[model samples]
Structure formats: structure tokens, C-alpha cells
Target: MEKYLEIIKNSYSSYWNYLKNSVFMELNWENYFYGLIIISLIVWGLEAIFPWRKNQSLFRKDFWLDTFYMFFNFFLLNLIVLIALSNSASELFNDVLGIVGLSIKNFQLLEINKLPFFTRIFIFFIVVDFVQWWTHRLLHRVEFLWNFHKVHHSVKQMGFAAHLRYHWMEPVVYNSLKYIPLAIIGGFSAKDIAFVHFFNITIGHLNHANINWDYGGLKYIFNNPKMHIWHHSRELPKERKYGVNFGITLSIWDYIFKTNYIPHSGRDIELGFEGDENFPKGFIQQEMYPLGRKD
Candidate 1:
């Protein structure tokens, strides 16, 4: 029995090393796609089974739109990564703002073997959430930024795809803007970077979920579905609650900013903008609206 256990451990160790070396090659498009599909399926399955709102339609008109934007969003992100790889404007931007003086790519060691899986994930979440919370709040206070970000707020309700509704430029600029500081701080590796994206995409869905779920006392610490619901409130009184619950992982920033609001009720809250009555519903319209309007 002891011999069998030793053999199992040796085999597992060898297999783990092989997996790390294989992934160290150029981006495995197959595995990349696999990771994306896995994330989407898990999120979609959760929505179907433990839906925030029981009667919510999983396939609504906005649902399709959200899905479309998800693909588009990813396309744009990959394009940026590509450009950053090449010596283009995107790379230039990354250079000027990157952690090091002019290095665009910060391929830190993908430390898959050094730690337990959960420990690595926990560290990544903490680092990524801190950066995201501040950047999200900055978008609210800065009027120019609010324009790009408003596309996200323009949504009337949260759907599975609702996480995709954002002005393309908003994320591009925001990503570059935040990553610069993160790179400088310089603790995150490639795996940590992947975890950042995984958490963002996953939590963004929860933020827009129709379910009236909350993390109970946990909302005071973490940004749950309900706290995010208020952030999208259409009522002026509620919209003012923006910037609280800034940390995607933890609501610590919101508590610090006094932006955290624990509601008395549940999913009955109205969503969307309070003043932007003429805001269009379509993606093209939302993109072009700010151009013609004074608001």
C-alpha cells in the first residue's frame, strides 16, 4: 500500500511539471478558449440553477445583446494584447504606463508549482480587487471618464451578458491605466493576471444578475450581487450611492469611502440612469449618443 501511494505521488509530481512547461510556450489558444468556455459555462449554469430571481428569463433580447458584447469585448482585449506585443500605439501606451520604464510585456513566472491552488487564487484576488476598486471609483468622479463608463450604466437591467455592455474604449483605457500601476507594484505573475480577468468577468455577471442575492454580513466586506444592484440604480437618491462597494472582491473600499449602502429591500429596485432619459438602448446608439448630446 505504501509503495502504491509513493508511485501515485511521483506520477502526480511529474505530471504537474509537464503541464507547467507545456503552458510556458506561446499562448495556447486551445487552452485559452477552453478556459473561456469553462468560465462561461460555470457562470451560466449558476444563473440557471440558483438564479438571483427565480422567474428571470435566461434568454431575453438584452440577453443576446449581452452575449454579442461579450465576444466583442474579448476581441478588443485580445487586439490590445496583440498590439502590446507588437510595437504599435497600444504597445506604446503600455510602455509609457507599464511597470518598468518601456517594457510592454511583463511575463513574470507562472508560479503554478510553488503554492497550493487556492492560496494562489486568494492572493491574486486580493491584488486585482484593490486595483479595480480604485479605478472604478475614479471613473465615477471624473466626468470625461464617466462618459465612456456610462455605456455600462445605460443598461436597464442586468442579464447574463449585461457584463459586456460597456464602451469599448472604457475598458481599453481603464485596463492600460490600471495595469501600469499593478506592474510597478510587481507581485502578480501570469497566473495571477489570468485570475484577475477570471474574477472580473465572473463578478461582473453577478453584479448584473437579476437575482436579489446578498452575502448577508459578508456584503459589508465583499461586494455582493445586491450591493452592485444599487450601484446601477436609476433613482437619483440611489445613484448617489455609486463608488461604494468599489472592490470587486471586498467592499472594504466602499466602507472606506462611505459609499457602501445596505438596502432594506431586495430585487425590486429600479435600475439604469436617473437623468439620461433619452439614452438609447442599442449598442450603436449608446456609443454615439454622447457625441450629439450636451449631457
Candidate 2:
């Protein structure tokens, strides 16, 4: 019986490994960059062609700061993830460290095999977003962590790279917290983890973009650029729209929390922080600003 169980576990491991390799290999670095370029081009095209912020241009200091974040996060931060995974009991550790796989494990309690792949993906993203919503809220409310997250809010302009402007430590803590639950439940495959990262990063970039693209009614299903821009707006009461579009993929949680804010009649919104006027322009300054202010 012990040998049989071992065989089953090995088979499962092999199947998962095959899936990971297949998925990861199919993701071309160039193609991913191309997609980002396309997203950026759209934002730029809208601004140039339709031109919302007449005085605002993409060449501002914030734009480059965001770009730096994008480069480091995609290349350096990802390298760190790979290194972390190389450690012994990496999967188990990831599970215990955060809630990454909790939903998947719990799903097993039901007839999860009957569910479709897209459904599973939906559930995973939703669960992570729910975790993130509260986590993000806490960071802002709590004094210490707020220093780390403030870097994200420092951006005055929206763009594909704004998502990457977040401090590295923020993800270390968030991803670690998430991985614990994921590992415990054995709910997530390696591929699932990668997909979540990719999908969230992509959406995050879109949300930060200044473009006027809206997914229409589908905006209810997912937080689009327009809705997210409102969150970043500097206007009074509008700036407090912070907690509404917390979901990385879906806006369901925002609706549940009564924090949903979607403007009708197309009211013009200002983007960026009004209260904190001392926001720095340099990359190093932004990262260190939180720590400097911590004490």
C-alpha cells in the first residue's frame, strides 16, 4: 500500500512537471515584450490622437521611474523567484509561508475534477485578489507597511509600467503570504502560479495606463483602465477610491465591499496624489522614501 501511494504521488508529480514545462516553454520572452509594447502603443496612441491630458506628456520623470520598475521586476525579481524555488522543500515552504494554494486544496473537498480549466483559473485569481484586497488595505491603514506600498501610489501618471513601480519588498511579503496557503492546500500547480503572476502583471500595467480603453460591460467582470484610473485620481473623495478596484482580475470583491466606483456621464478625473506633495522623482528615492519615513 505504501509503495502504491508512492507510485501515485510520483505520477502526479510527473504530470505536473510536464504541464509546467509545456506552459513555460510556450511563453516567448520576445512575444511577451511585444504584447507589452502593443499595450503601451495603444496608450500612447490614445493620448496623442484623442489627447485627454493636453498639457501632460509621457516624457515626464514618473514615466522613466515606472519603466525602471518594469525592467527590474520582470528580469531581476523573477530571477529571485527562480532562485527561491530552487531551495529544498520549496513547494511545501511556499504553501506554509502564504495562502497561495488554499483555495485549490479546499476545492478538492468538492468534486473539483468536474470543474473546467477556465473555472479553476477564475477561482484562483479571485481567491488571490480577495487575499490581496485586504492585504493592500491593511498596508495603507497600518503605519509600517504603508511605507513600502507608498511607492506604488507615488506615480502621478498612468502607464503600462506603473504597476511595476511597487517596492520589491511588497511582493516578497505578499507572494510569500500567498504561497503559504497555496502550498498547504497543494491547490496550485507551478504553471498556475506563473499564470497568476503573468495575468496580474498584465492587468496591473493596463490599469496604470492613461489610455481610455474600456472593456465595456466586461468592465464589471474585470477592473479596466478607466476604473483603475479613478482609483489613482488625486481628487478629494475620489482619491479615497483606493480600496475599490482591489481585485487583480475581477471587480466582484469591490462590489461586495461597497467600494465599487464607476463614473457615469464620463466625468474628467485627475490622476495622482494631492496630499503628499513631496513625492520624489528618482527610482532610488522612491524605494528609500518609505524606509526613510518609517521612523
Candidate 3:
């Protein structure tokens, strides 16, 4: 027990040190570019060999637009939004907690860092996933939120790049909400957050890819392309709940909440918002879309 505690303490110290250095250092664009290229190549290769919809071309309609969305959201817009919001949101949350006399600093006394590494990772993953799942549902059910989210569902064809095709404001909402829970828990290190982020990004791309694999029985557990494809479907049976299946990394939340919807097959289903045939086609127009009508 003493040895395990020591190991955990050392690991925690090392992670914080690394995080501090990373914050002070220049952003590593080389690594970011390399990772993007590698993941794109792997997904593109798999889609080429075993595509779900053989009729769908690699350069389908709005493909370049989706590519631009990917880079813009991942590289430029998300960074600016996250940096602008994180500190202000954190301070605001802490102040609210102070008013209630329930401080996050006190919660940090619980020493969640002493827990096993994998255990911390597991808890972080589940918490973040559940938070995102709720956020996704809100983006669908709330008309205002849905306006920004419509940029994503407007995709008539699915591809790996489509994973990053989201409105800039969408992340501001989700990321802000996600931080509240983490702050309350008070023990998640930067590394824990990074782990969950990596998992979300990897699975998100896979879920949006054109690949055909469904993982058979695991479809009920993890989000897969087949299941997510239906989430983007333009039509659904009258008896089924509209806007169902909003899970981001795990399908279990949808199953528990009774929003899970999976058709026998999604190959023939037409994807996109039903009445949004004229949704803006360019990145700038789409960015301006959620801000309401312009004369």
C-alpha cells in the first residue's frame, strides 16, 4: 500500500511538472499536424478498402468545405474560444461555489490523485462522456442550440473530417459545462483531461468515418459508425423518438436514458436535416448562421 501511494504521488508530481512546462512552451504544431495526417490516412485507407456506402465518392458534395471546417475548428477557432472562456468560466464557477460555501479547494482534500492511474482515467472518461452526452441532447432539443448544431447535421455524406465540422460556439457551451463537474471533483490533472480528450477525438473520427465495421455486440456499449449514422439520418419512423441517440463516446447513456435508436441498416438512409436543404455551404456563412438572420 505504501509503495502504491508513493508511485501515485510521483506520477502526479511528474504530470503537473510536464503540464506546467507545456503551458509555458510554444504550441507544437508539428506534432498536431503529424497526428492529424496519421489518423486521416488510417481512416481514409480503411474507408477506401471497406466503405459502407460504395456509391459515396471520396470527394463527395461539400467535401472541401468539411475539410476546411476540420482545420478551422481544430486549429484556429477552438483554441481562441477555449482560451477566452476557460479562465473566466473557472473564476465564475469558483465564485458561485464560494457563495454556496462549497469550495472546490475543499473538495481537493479528498486526494483523488492517490487513486490508481487507470481508475482515475476510467472515472474521468465516464464523467466527461456523460456530460457531453447531456450537452449533445441539449443541442438537439433546444432550438437556439440546434441552430449552431445544424451545421454538423447538414452533412449529407459522412467522413472522418466531418467529426470536426461543428460551430465554434458549440464547443464554448460544452467545454464550459464540462469544466464545472471537473472543478467540483477537484482532483483531475491536466493529463486526465488530455486522456479523455484523445479518446473522444479518436472515437469521434471513427464514429463519423465511412467504414462499415459495427463491432457487432459491442455496438450497444461503444458508439460506432452504424449507430451514429442513424443520429444523422434525415428521417425516422413515426413511432420512434425524434433526435435520439446523442451519445458521444459511449452508447450506454442513450440506452439508460432510452434515447438509443438503431435501425436494422443505415445504408439506404438519407442523412441531413430534412428541411435544411439550403443550409449555408461555406464556413463563414455557417459560422454566421447561429447568430440569427442578417438583412
Best by lDDT: 3
Query: Is 1 or 3 the stronger prediction by TM-score?
Result: 3
| lDDT per residue (tens digit) for residues 1-295 in model 3 | 4544454555555444544454555335323444565677788788889899998897867778888888777756634455545655566666778998976786664466889888988978888889999999999878888888999999889998898899998988888888867766668776676566667777888899898988888888899899999999998777653597898989999899989888678876889986787888878888898897542
Return the number of clashes found in candidate 2: 17
Tens digits of lDDT, candidate 1, 94-210: 545565554533544444346776776676666667777777888888777787778888766566577777776666565666565445444555666676666676666666666
Q: What is the lDDT of residue 170 in candidate 2?
A: 82
Off by over 4 Å in 3: 1-33, 96-102, 107-110, 239-241, 293-295
Superposed Cα deviation of residue 32, candidate 3 (Å): 4.3
Looking at model 1, the pairs that clash are 52-211, 53-211
**Residue-level lDDT tens digits of model 2 in 1-295:** 4544454566556544544554466545323444455656665565566544456676654777677787676555545442343333354443554666453344434443356767766667776887787777777667788777777877766666787778877876676566544444444555565667667766776666655667788877777777776666566364553444565656667777877776652225655665558777677777778777736
TM-score of each: 0.72, 0.71, 0.84
Every candidate's CA RMSD: 11.2, 7.3, 7.9
What is residue 112's positional error in candidate 2, in angstroms?
Answer: 6.5
Error of 2 at 280 (Å): 2.2
Rank the models by lDDT, top first. Answer: 3, 1, 2
Model 1: CA > 4 A from native: 1-32, 80-124, 238-243, 292-295
> Pairs clashing in candidate 3?
none
Q: Each candidate's lDDT (Cα)?
A: 0.64, 0.62, 0.79
